[model samples]
Target chain A: MSDSLFENLRLELRRGCLTLAVLANLRTERYGYTLRKALEEAGLEMDEGTLYPLLRRLEGQGLLASEWREENKRRKRFYRLTPDGERMFDHLAAELQRINASLERIIAEAHA
Target chain B: MTTLFERYLHAVGEALPKDVVAADVTAEIADDLHSRAEEREAELGRELTDEEAAAILREYGDPRVVAARYGRVQSLIGPELLPYYWSTLTLALVVVVALELVVGGISAIVRADGLRFFSALDVAVHSLVWVFTIVTVIFAAAERVPQGRQRLARVMRWDPRALAAPSALPPVARSSSLAEFIANTLALLVLLDARGAHRVPLDRLVATMLSDLHLTLTVAWQPALVGTAVGAALVAIAAMIAFLRPQAAVVHEMLRMLGSVVAIVGLAMTLASGPLFDPGGGIATTIGYVTLGAAIAVLAVQAVLSVRALLVRAPMPTPKSARG
Candidate 1:
């Protein structure tokens, strides 16, 4: 595949996983900068504009709660998943697993 | 330190809404660009200049597009509303045109023999009526279209924050005001000429009115002229007010009321004066009076519809508890 085409497919895949990734990472409380770096380390690059708004939206929708706290002499807003978010995340994770298994089966059959 | 990367980020930041373009986002993007440039430089075993980093940032699509991707939902008007808009517009235009024709035909029949007496005045009034009908119908039709509504909505969404910031008035309002001014001036001149002569011939009447008035010493004509001017000015002002404040609803209603009043007065003056103040004989004059009455009726109906549409309130959104 062309690099550009592959990049687009990768972005499409990442788009679905963004909410999941944010929830998974927020299983522990983390600030915007730390969460961004962690996601990049896991090979999922997100820009600040995309991430911050998603955080705000998720919080608005009651999936996440956030508060500004003093950390290392700097004011940082940290986010964490609510109980509702945790239940939603588990449902999503199960659905993702099923999708992954189906995809893997298709790929294995194609190779065989 | 100020760098090309920082400047690029700033350019993008300026394009975004203030709340979206926070200092944190700016700093993070700036850092990413700097790190990427440094990494590329180290890998190549050479120094990457600020200019080279700037070029890379430019190759990435414009900052506005990048920022927009975060949460910019599509803004298209839904397809379902298009048919409603088109049907309503076509129906309204047909009704208005039909009304104009009916009134025009009645007047023509009534003044059939008196044509000679009021020929100039008849032509002028007919032309003015035609022009007003065409212009208003066009405006009403345009307003019903989805794109027109969107354009109107944008104009209406005035932020006091934006008011202090430099922005030009929307082009639609500006152009409409200019057109209204010109139309009013022309209408005033024609109406004044029509009123000035009692029963003179067309050519002689115009010549006499112009020659006697000489354009400069036309102060005596100011009352009628100013009345028409004021009416036109009100309509134009009302349109701008409607454009800026569609939610108010009353502004549009007021415009419709004011327009009806002007039309009524103009029609009454035209009919009562009898083709430029020369009273005609027989059924022709009676027909002219009836035609004037029909025009008044049409205006009255339009005023009622405008008021009804404006005053009818939409049902309030049900509360969450009620929804359950």
Candidate 2:
């Protein structure tokens, strides 16, 4: 039960971070497979189901733009951050840094 | 032969919500899956086997779950419209059942065949199924229109003061009058076209049915044409009156009764002339008889209702000062 609880909490924690990572990585136009590979290289491994749907939702929210184009003799849908998406990413990234700094400070004080 | 990969994509596509763009999503997923397989093949230095592809698909998650992530499965009829849906369904079902019973009963009595009741039961069940599907689809579609609920609410709003006494002539609804007018006009056109030199689609259909039955309706045309024309004309007159006056229930009902009687007499006269089709037996004959019987039964019911309406005493007109 404890293990399952930890796993659930871990997933909840990763969810927002993964979305943030996706937005950050999409600074360059990339298709699904390439994007996943990029995120994996950045130490954020996401399931296909989770990643694709998240991309779709972000696009639906007008934060991401996608278009089908030919690459390597095959059609692939490429996604990138829209202007609004760029602003949102910048805002969220700053917020994350502030939160991280506060968390580190609290942790160091507790340890002392 | 569909590959396991293709089948998996298809399954996912099937599980997606109606509103979702399944084709585009499935295509993207397919590309990703193919990429995964290619990477695995590169690692192993060979093409991946079916089992390896299956493993990849299995790792993704259940098709339904994967689809659920993309879009929610919304209710066809939402909670807001559910009560109205139920009420409409109930009313439609009651009308269908009543119609089936009456028509079936009359057909059985006329043919002296008790089995007609069974056929009627069969027809009733079929009609109920159709009615349920139609009503559900209509309501489901209606739910999608944001303004539909508001429109329906507005239509259903009632005024206590507008309620007339039992003796008062019920106000004629222009919409209903317009509908009646259109129905009568279209019917008259079909009848005239069928009788005259010009052959319409309805005429062609009748010709096909008659040909299939090895029957000729040349003898029956006169009575059928006469009946339909006279009946439709009377109904058209009633519709015009209703449209013009909007407070002539008595006149409308009387005309409607006269129309029903004219149509019934025409049908009865044709029926009295003997069998409509050449000697034949089986399901076709049963269908033909049931159709005729149902038509007569419907008209008879309409006539009875019209008579009842005529019998009701009109309410006394209120003085203009009292109206306030």
Candidate number achieving the greatest DockQ relative to the actual structure: 2
- Please report, in order, the local distance difference test score of every candidate based on alpha carbons: 0.59, 0.79
> Per-residue alpha-carbon lDDT of model 2 for B1-324, expressed as tens digits?
128888888999999978789999999998888888888889999988778888888898898888888764256787877877776886687567656744664454345454554587689889989999999998877766768766765665768879756645577899999899889856755665554333467778877777786766545435655675668767866786677667767778888899899888887777666555565456655675677668789999999988887777865777899877
In terms of TM-score, the best-performing candidate is: 2
- Supply DockQ values for each candidate: 0.14, 0.58
| lDDT tens per residue, model 1, A4-105 | 999899888888799899999999999887898899999888876678768877887899988767765556677899999899899999999999999999
Task: Report, for all candidates in order, the number of backbone clashes.
Answer: 1, 3
Q: After superposition, which runs of candidate 1 have C-alpha atoms over 4 Å from their true positions?
A: A1-14, A25-56, A59-84, A98-112, B18-21, B44-47, B70-73, B76-324
When only the first chain is scored, the TM-scores of the models are: 0.90, 0.94
* TM-score result, candidate 1: 0.38
Query: Every model's Cα RMSD, please?
Result: 15.6, 17.5
Query: How high is the lDDT of residue A60 in model 1?
Result: 71
Question: In model 2, what is the error at residue B187, expressed in angstroms?
Answer: 68
Error of 1 at A37 (Å): 7.0
